[model samples]
Target: MTVKEVKKGNACALLPLIIFVALFIGAGVLTKDFSNMPLNVAVIIASAVALLMNRKEKFEIKVSIFTKGAGHPNIMLMAIIFILAGAFATVAKGMGAVDSTVNLGLSLLPANLLMVGLFAIGCFISISMGTSMGTVVALAPIGIGIASQTDIPVALTMATVIGGAMFGDNLSMISDTTIAAVRTQHTKMKDKFKVNFFIVLPGAILTAIILGVITRGNKAVIGADFHYELIKILPYIAVLAAALAGVHVLIVLIGGTIFAGGVGLADGSYSFGSFLKTIGEGLMSMEDLAIIALLIGGLVEVIRHNGGIDYLLYTVNSKIKSKKGAEFGIAGLVSAAAIATANNTISIVVTGPLAKSIADEYEIDPRKSASLLDTFAGSWQGILPYGGQMLAAAGLAAISPVSIIPYSFYPILMGGCAILAILNGYPKLGTKSKEVKQVATVPVEE
Candidate 1:
């Protein structure tokens, strides 16, 4: 057995992750700008720290350990999906799909339902785009516009946008977080989405009602202010529909890209040259995430090899007895990862493997674990002051991120709903894991 495969875990194995998080959040806190600390750089430093530990092993063995984790099939597939999803998204947006979809959602909104409408729109756009940041960036200005026209506070309006963005982020078929959660837990993306969507639906509805009450008597004059081409919105709808129908993700993305590019060409939205260029730009946009995944995988492998994961699991497992306790442990794990990273996608990637192991150990359904991973991470990332989603929304609205916290009804309610789901054991995907009994037989046949 290796150092990591021991009956007793080594507590010291966790130092690398601790140091990385410290550097990341510490630098962000000091600079008051989380973006100042590049995740790639911090992870690289942490990885080096991990390599320096347990130096008695041959250097080749140490390098092999990192490579083993970095080259994991799940991690490799996730990077490919990220790259493909980015390309599809870029093509769709290049064809005016995002703008048209936004315009269409807003144009249909009843003037009195502005706040709830924005929330719903945020959800739709984020779901289609598979990115909360993209949704926030696209809708923050619109939220501000609506706020200026109505009695709603910009903070509340912006919070609504953040809520909607996160809702979709937690459940979007193509979201990297969802992909990571599903891939790591070995569950189908559609299965995870279905479970995650229902789990958070109540919270979303309640949030809408709350926004409705808060925005009562307030009118948003968005009439005739935006124009949309219905045809331009087809690609998003097509991709979403196909994915939910359980089509292969790669097919959905590639087909969506081709369809969107054809539309863009026909509409003169972009030339053939521009279409190729947009694909390149999209791929580039995802490079950081892809690279980060590889580095994190390698870093985490080193940690795991040193028994950090085993120790953490041992600690969590000690207090968890029943299935409910296991679920709670998973929730706690997801939430802590989110709190540390302040990015839902990164948090999911950071905790995915560990969550899977916990699920297997407890025989908890992988789907439930996946849902918790996405939902909890989404819930926490939105309300955090230093999170990119909140920071981006605040920056666009020219308001304090702190002000947005009071009105972040969706994510707060989301966390509550997730807890309730655990308490009730919703979905009841009865434990599918069982211990294998090795049957021994003498060589009687010989």
Candidate 2:
């Protein structure tokens, strides 16, 4: 009458991603479409399974764990950004601001260089804004218009925007990933950026060339009579200026919403009542993302509590045999966490404590570790089908998030540079830096 089997607790930690993929298959069967269904529902279902896994634990403990994850500061911050971004975007689109802005951009740039221009613009905006989500919000809609009026694929354009955003977000001094990495590793931000910038420069250049080639043969289909109003394009300009001025993102979006609303009223794009309606509609559009983010936050907490994080660390750290090996270990650990959490900042934060320990053990420079944490996490997150950046871009483009991964050129190249940095130990810290004393050790028998 007694059970003899023991559960593999850590293995169960992967239940969420497993269930999410299964839901895609199930959706394909039920609805004949795998990409556009309710992905948040998959997270919800996985959450339930996570709660039920450890029956020996108190129910209150399980609820508390779920609640803490759902209420994490980072997750809450992202939810708020989503709501504000939606409101700004909706009000702008409802006011014809999007069309006017597109017209201006199309008129100013030639067809052959439009994709390159978008990528370059995305890099500048993301660096200024210090938030890839903010960058994507500002540019993806314009990319959509460019795609519609040209021969380029919507997915490729979306991918280009995201790739550029990641490039800047990884190196921006004000970015959350950069801030988290520097603070966790106790290094100066400027120092980290110097090393980080050099590592990513080659990748950025290569990505630009690739975009230019892919877009060269494409022609603009816009007619000579295409028109736009300069007055209506102020909203995007205002957003970009405020971001460049170092304004906080929350204020940027709130101010953008109000400014866009004022413009809408002045131009009679929408009546006051319809303006309110547009705001409501905008909030509704991002609800799925907010819900999914909360579920993922909670699900990741459950996985960590069940030893999933430790298992990854052990799996990677066990392979270290030298200083260089330790550097790669940090990369692999952070990369794995990014794939699991689908968030770059959270991945760096969760893995930082152990990474610092590894850096100390091997005497690897803090600057290097900080750069590695941000680089590796960013490279992985930029391509994750479930990450916020991909979801936001795809939602704006009316396409599946998975569709953009094939064109994530910058992220793919950034990873290559990171690997090379590890191998070559570029920017080698002088031997004058602290080094651990060699102590004789005894091997333990298994």
- For each candidate in turn, the TM-score is 0.94, 0.64
Which pairs of residues have clashing backbones in candidate 1?
Answer: none
Q: After superposition, how far is residue 93 of candidate 2 from its true place, in Å?
A: 3.0
Candidate 2: residue 276 Cα off by (Å):
2.2
* lDDT score for residue 77 of model 1: 72
CA lDDT for candidate 2: 0.75
- Please give the lDDT score for candidate 1: 0.86
Tens digit per residue, CA lDDT, model 1, 248-347: 8878888988999999999999899999999999988999999899999999999988889888887877787887898898888879878987878888
- Give a tens-digit lDDT track for model 2, residues 337-383: 68756778767765775687678767788889989999999999788
Error of 2 at 299 (Å): 2.1
Candidate 1 Cα RMSD after full superposition onto the native fold (Å): 5.5
**Of the candidates shown, which would achieve the greatest TM-score relative to the real structure?**
1
